[model samples]
Target: MFTSAIPSLRWLQGFEAVARLGNVTRAAEALFISQSAVSHQIAQLEAHLGQPLFRRVGRGMELTMAGEFLLDTVGKALDHIRSGLGRLDTYLDAQLLTIVCPADIAQGWLQARLHSLQAQLPNLCPVVSVDETARYVDQVDVDVVISRSPLQQAGLTERVLFDDALVAVCTPALAAALAQSPQPGGFICLEGDAMSATVGPHLRQHFAGWSRRGMFDDARLLLDAALRGLGVAVLSRAVASEALAQGRLQCWPGFAPLPNGSLWLAQAQEPRSALIEQVVAHLLSETP
Candidate 1:
């Protein structure tokens, strides 16, 4: 009967992580082990295999041929294990929940709120997926779906994330163009999913000439265009906050403040976990 003279599963895990990350410290951090411990485990594994598994690189490590072979197989095995473990963990933490939200919300808003969620619910991990602007997420994929409002479907639970009013932000030079230009035109731009039509009645009313404006499906792209003084772009404050602070984009006070800028956090009506509320609380809590 053939058996693994390689090493224990723990040592293999350390080896795979260290090999993939190409560094002992980072691998240790990812594997939740001490660097010295990982190093020791690798050495033990190498001794058992009767060959060196790694070679020194510039302040890092690289896998030797044997190490590479083991890593290729072990990496796939570990990934499968992780996926299985994730499922098991979710099952154990049945009260934990997750959601799919706007890309901007995940990167801009929710990102800054994760610490609070961890503080409130220690086992929480918001599985964020950047999807349609107003689309509903599969209940099986995520516990909730966070998106701009004007309910697309009637079903599912909804929590307000706060109105993400569209503020036309541009550089000082662009602002001067808007103020100096005689004609009232949305010649500037506004970015979001092309599907942002589902936002609300107020969005349609305010962005009267959205067709003429620089339309984009991605907020980051529009934010970039606006930064380059392309045109005045109506953007979510959350996504533009950093640039706005840096004086890269200045808000254009040309129109009434958007009142329907509210974003909604939607979950299945019969959710099986408390993860949604935990995620919502973190997402909605004001940032200081």
Candidate 2:
């Protein structure tokens, strides 16, 4: 079962780690080994495969053409192996679904509706992960992910959860002040993030003449700023519902809701489990 002519799995593991992270030190840290060890493993792997797998570029490393080919094949193998191993343990456990979501959406929407999930899936012991970068959803091997942007990975089942809407709102006093002046940069603005990409165009379209008195990346914080009368803010309906109902803030007149597409729920298609199916169904039916 062993041969010197064949490369070792340890070498392959090291190669995969290095290729994914593009840093030998990070790969070593991920593998819980010394950087020197990772470098040695990569060297041995290259020697065995008879090809240069990586090349130094500026301050970092880039995969070679050979490296890309190996990664494309090796990466799928690794994912399959990991998924298989994960399925061997508690795969059918109703309480074992792991859900990944964006931070703002989690704080604004999912947190409020968690009780509904509990009521419908009493056996679900949900583990929630908040990843704004969204780089490691597949690597973490989550059971489900609620995403504003689709991950678009292969072998994933996509389901529409709900559509999102953004509206401009602020305290009554702030609204009155804006009505008086309506100068450029007079509103709170969100820039440089996924939420900004989704809502920024709508904001400029509605308040083309207004100026930004404040800028925020977090929608919840933006809502708070709006509540304190800092400036008018664009907020998702889910995040602004309570404040609007309580009369804490009023909507800016003449701005209608802008559709932000459906929030998608995705999971691997194969190795399907009843637990995942049931929970997804519950989320679809009970999210009102």
Candidate 3:
């Protein structure tokens, strides 16, 4: 077994800044230390490595072969450290718990319940990001992901919110008008960059014969289109609940609820902070 010598972080940092700037003075300025301090740090680092890191070339300094090797290794090490620290910063700011999910959920479900959540946890800072792509679980920076897809990532925990029960809906007037003839021109469908797999095929299978006037990715836009009597739209019951209850949109009869994977609240199993646990509990409680 081989053991590598460990160098001081301060020495490594000084060497990296100097190597990058190619000037001791500039590196010292950047590091906010005296030029002598920077030179001393580099000397200490080179002494540990048993090699000369720089050679005098007129008024300037050039990297030796050993210096080049060290530069490459140390540069990467610094970058990795910086990246890791950035990610750590995200975790440290426990005041905010970021919830990443589909736009439909943001607009239809979470947005409405946001105030209630804030009221329940006054100190809780929740940041909601709308992923039109609906791949929030795959985003590394996301703290909590509400996914319609199954949580397959290793070391991640999931809690099922509710099974997807979707319904075809349009304005009451449109439903009444289209009852006689549910043509292609009276149907709306999801097209590009659709967030969920459940919507398109389910619509096609059930309303296969219904004519489609347009296709879109935005659930809110689709809902708006339905409200304007553009065509019937297939939407998750939770997303369409408010519209249905208020009579803004009415469910078209003869279509039973379409089945899909249950909505899942997913988070990393390890590094489970109390704040994250609190937010997860709140979401579970709010699930209908």
Candidate 4:
């Protein structure tokens, strides 16, 4: 299955390396080949494409417009190939299920439910990846992803996990003290831009002279600070639900909870197996 229109992968690799490193010697060193071999491959690639992919710029090579276009396309192709190769583990191990989600969601909500999830699927070997910046499942090889917002990518199905709310919570002892005194105190805040904007005005209007004690990008960290009696932490209600239920933390009185974004569970439309479907169902059933 050789396509005459397409250049050899070796030639493309050499071309990409030279374009990136800007020197044939460096590209050869990276590829574990001689400098002449790299140069020869690049020349073959240029001749096959009927264009000069690079031009000599002093000691280094600079890509031509055509080379730039090819580099972009080739880079994406290589990345996709690499991701597919990395996912061979899932194919070899049928019981493995890789789930990716935000760190806060992982620590706050999902951690408590692992035992129950395993009980539902005894053969399941769950691999949870926590990345606060992850917004899409395609960025990695994952069986399912929990996201703050619904993903609109093609070939993906999304299910609503739960609606979230931002609430101010503190230790029960702190709440009792605040109830008696009714004075402004140090506040722990989430560092999200939108959340900070909403919380800043509310704190100023309701609790005048409120000073920030700590700011955390992660809700789990913010909750930890609040539990230590550091300050009143404004975080996702779901993140603090377990602690609140256990009486380790309490919702501060007089402040209404603010509506927040919903969490959505998303997976490929064509799941790898029936077990994945069962796992998804179990998660949905467990959601309140």
Candidate 5:
């Protein structure tokens, strides 16, 4: 309240533009204001300081020596301001999105689809955050969000990515062991509590009497455990199909590739940022 130094942001803005453009008309257009208004503000500002800031030329204005000195200071300050805004815009645009998903879904679903997403959205760089036991959507701070949710919120939009089919999977060695021995305990099931929440109850109801020895949150982790012949894991066709085809994963007959893992990509409902909108379009076409 007792400060001797106080400056106006609008005056600085007006002064900066008028100095750079050397014309009130150009300054007004750049500032989105009327030429007469800019003139009035400049007049008021100069009057308050009791100094001449601009000299009138033939239908134009030129910076005075005092204005020249102030211009240097103003230019530096404005450049810094513009630089800050540029950085802020990138952060908001998700030039890179930190995608949060269950560890396995990131590996099985998202990672598999990354090449397609990258191909479609050449500018997008999505960073994956592994969180398999996660229950809620973790993209409040990130630009793009891809995950399954219980329901859509008021400010977020949801797109159906794919309908995933679950099937029990095992490594070739484990499949051979099952083919030879075929006993309950011999079936070293990959234990994962995370699947139970996302795809477990359905497995329990449909594919009964498989050994539950291990639990995992992400499909990639579960697949890895199964690949090592640790146990069987209930995973989606999207997650298991390639592995199965490559002979790394084998399906147990009659399990029916139980229906679960309804994939959804959630994003802000309003689509505030242009980059977010592009990501939504790219994700819709991404195959991973």
Candidate 6:
């Protein structure tokens, strides 16, 4: 445990100013204080420390050995204090918006739209956090949240981003091969409580005989495996949309996707600032 024996900041400021300028009048001018006030503060500090920090040399002040040591430490400490205040200012900046969502949503949906969002709001600085377990909008300090399920918290406005569906997707070559005969490759599975519950029955009924090539906790990884021709991956339609449009992966025919869940965009009903409202509006305008 540390004792509260430290001197006041005003006294330290006076001491530092006097030490640097080497004159009481100049130090008082720099601090916007009377010379008497600076002199009083220095006197109080020296009395508190039980030692004279400065030596009177003609008309100017000179630091003693102890004063030199204290100045070095005090200068660094003041710099750190200024730096911490600067960081706080950044957090309070209106243009910095933080958006939180699941890893899959960040990678598949939000990441692509971020560039356009920034283009619209040129001063906007977005901070995105990929957290799968963040279910509530108030659970973290974020301006917006993209969730698969509706957040039941109060003081939040939610909009359905899209109705998500699970689709079986694979490379064009793999889809072509499966059209003629059952492909030799296994099924890439997304392993999570909710995802397993959704995809488990589908896989058992459709491709029970196929082996398991890879099991991933992230839908992004599952999509990547399918793109690499590792195996047929059952992933969210939104996750595979870009790839399907680009013709990198083809939807397996005869396997109609099942409605899995709805993706929602949620934010505080009373936003921190009007800038947050504009950002959220921009996001909604871009949503399909």
Candidate of highest lDDT: 6
The best candidate by TM-score is 6
Question: For residues 184-204, could you state the per-residue lDDT of candidate 3 as single tens digits?
Answer: 435775574233465556666
**lDDT tens digits, residues 1-288, model 5?**
223354687888998999999899999999999999888888877876778889999988888998998899989999999999886666566566656665556666567567666776788777677653333333334544556653455566677777777677777777777677756532333345334575456667544676567666556766777788887666667767567766888887656665666777776666555776766676676544
The residue-by-residue lDDT of candidate 6 on 1-288, one tens digit each, is: 223499999999999889889999999999999999999999998888888889999999999998999899888887899899898778678888778888776777777678777887799888888865655555235778888777777889998988888888999998777667855557786886225665677777777678888888878888889999998888888888778777999887667788878888889888887888887877677665
- Tens digits of per-residue lDDT for model 1, 1-288: 224664699888888888888899999999887999999999888888888889999989988898888888888988999899888666456655555667776765666567556776776755566766536544455666767764556667666767666676778986776578667545344444334565444456665664355677677777777787777676678777667766777777755555436777776676665666556555666632
Which 10-residue span in candidate 4 carries the lowest summed lDDT?
132-141
Residue-level lDDT of model 2, residues 194-248, one tens digit each, is 2466566777777787767888777878878888888777777767766776688
1 or 6, greater by lDDT = 6
Q: Rate the local accuracy (lDDT) of all candidates.
A: 0.69, 0.76, 0.75, 0.81, 0.69, 0.81
Model 1 CA lDDT for position 105: 64
Q: How does residue 102 of candidate 6 score in lDDT?
A: 81
Q: How would the candidate models be sorted by TM-score, starting from the highest?
A: 6, 4, 3, 2, 5, 1
Ranked by lDDT, top first: 6, 4, 2, 3, 1, 5
Deviation of model 3 at 223, angstroms: 3.1
The better-scoring model by lDDT among 3 and 4 is 4
Q: After superposition, how far is residue 253 of candidate 5 from its true place, in Å?
A: 1.7
Predicted structure 5, TM vs. truth: 0.52
* Clash-forming residue pairs, model 1: 97-275, 163-261, 163-262, 164-261, 170-250, 188-232, 189-232, 189-233
Which tens-of-lDDT digit does each residue in 1-288 have in candidate 4? 223597888998899889888899899999999999999998888888888889999989999998999999987887788798877755447677778877787777776676678876788888888854554554235778898877787789998899988888899888777668766787887777225676667755655687778888767788899999999888888788778878999888777778778989998888877777888888787675
List the candidates' TM-scores in order.
Answer: 0.47, 0.54, 0.61, 0.63, 0.52, 0.76
> How high a TM-score does candidate 4 get?
0.63
Model 1 — which ten-residue stretch has the worst lDDT?
A: 186-195
For candidate 3, report its TM-score: 0.61
With candidate 4 superimposed using the best TM-score fit, by how many Å does residue 283's alpha carbon deviate from the native? 2.0
* TM-score for candidate 6: 0.76
What are the RMSD figures for all models against the true structure? Answer: 11.2, 13.1, 6.5, 9.8, 8.7, 4.1
Name the lDDT value of residue 177 in candidate 6.
76
